[model samples]
Target: DQQVKQNSPSLSVQEGRISILNCDYTNSMFDYFLWYKKYPAEGPTFLISISSIKDKNEDGRFTVFLNKSAKHLSLHIVPSQPGDSAVYFCAAGEMNRDDKIIFGKGTRLHILP
Candidate 1:
């Protein structure tokens, strides 16, 4: 069973528009969730995170919302820019498991100029 999945492998949006990416998880035991942005040939950088106890977290242009009931989460970026084009990964971890994180394949975001 896939513990985490990003159904859309890629997306394209024009600059200055809203870009939304989605993720789903099957493991309810995952208590910590994070979004990471990655560039070509580079490792992912932590974007935002939400503990199971919380529903939403935001940092600047990035926002993440978690729906525990649906075991789903999403990332939204407003005024998307060309620089925002990159791969985004949704990761889940169990705090009790010592923060061992599991990642979705990734969503490649292409911001059209």
Candidate 2:
């Protein structure tokens, strides 16, 4: 069964605007959330992350918000740029439980000019 899910298979956002990618998880054991960005021919790279204890975390133009009650999380990229166009993978794991991380199918984000 899929523990994590990214409902939208693709998302298009205009450059210089805000891009929001959403994710949901059915496993309550997940206490850590992470966002990864992958390009055409490369492995996914760590973007941002958050813990269950925090509602939001921000780094540069990227931010991640986690809602434990809803088992939902989102990644927000402000002032979306052309370089931001990539497939974003949402991951969740239990920090204290194990090192296994469940990843979603990923959502392709296109930054349109």
Candidate 3:
């Protein structure tokens, strides 16, 4: 079974608008969540991360929120720019357990002008 799931395969948002990417998980053992952004022909780079102890974590234009009860998380980008267009992957794993992190299929985000 897939532990991490990104229901939306793709998303489109106009420039200067907020883009929200949603994700869900089935594993309650996950104590950490991470978001990664990848451009074509390039490896994914870490965007932001959140611990189960916290509900939200922000880094500049990106923010990640975790809802433990709902087993859901989301990434919000304010003033989405064209450069922000990429595939975003939601990952989750237990920090103290193993090094294996489950990843979603990824959601392709298109930032329109």
- Clashing pairs in model 2? none
Cα error, residue 15 of model 1, in Å, equals: 0.4
User: How would you encode candidate 1's per-residue C-alpha lDDT over 30-108 as one tens digit per residue?
Assistant: 9999999999999889899999998988889898999999999999999799999999999999987764688999999
How far residue 15's Cα lies from its native spot in candidate 3, in Å, is 0.2
**Across residues 1-113, which tens digit of lDDT does each residue of candidate 3 receive?**
99999999999999999999999999999999999999999999999999999999999999999999999999999989999999999999998986789999999999999
Best prediction by lDDT: 3
CA-lDDT, candidates in order: 0.94, 0.96, 0.97
Better of 1 and 3 by TM-score: 3
Query: Of the candidates numbered 1 and 2, which has the greater lDDT value?
Result: 2
Would you estimate the TM-scores of all the predictions? 0.96, 0.97, 0.98
Top-TM-score candidate index: 3
lDDT of 2 by residue, 36-98 (tens): 999999999999999999999999999999989999999999989999999999999988875
- Model 2 residue 39 lDDT score: 99
Query: lDDT: which is higher, 2 or 3?
Result: 3
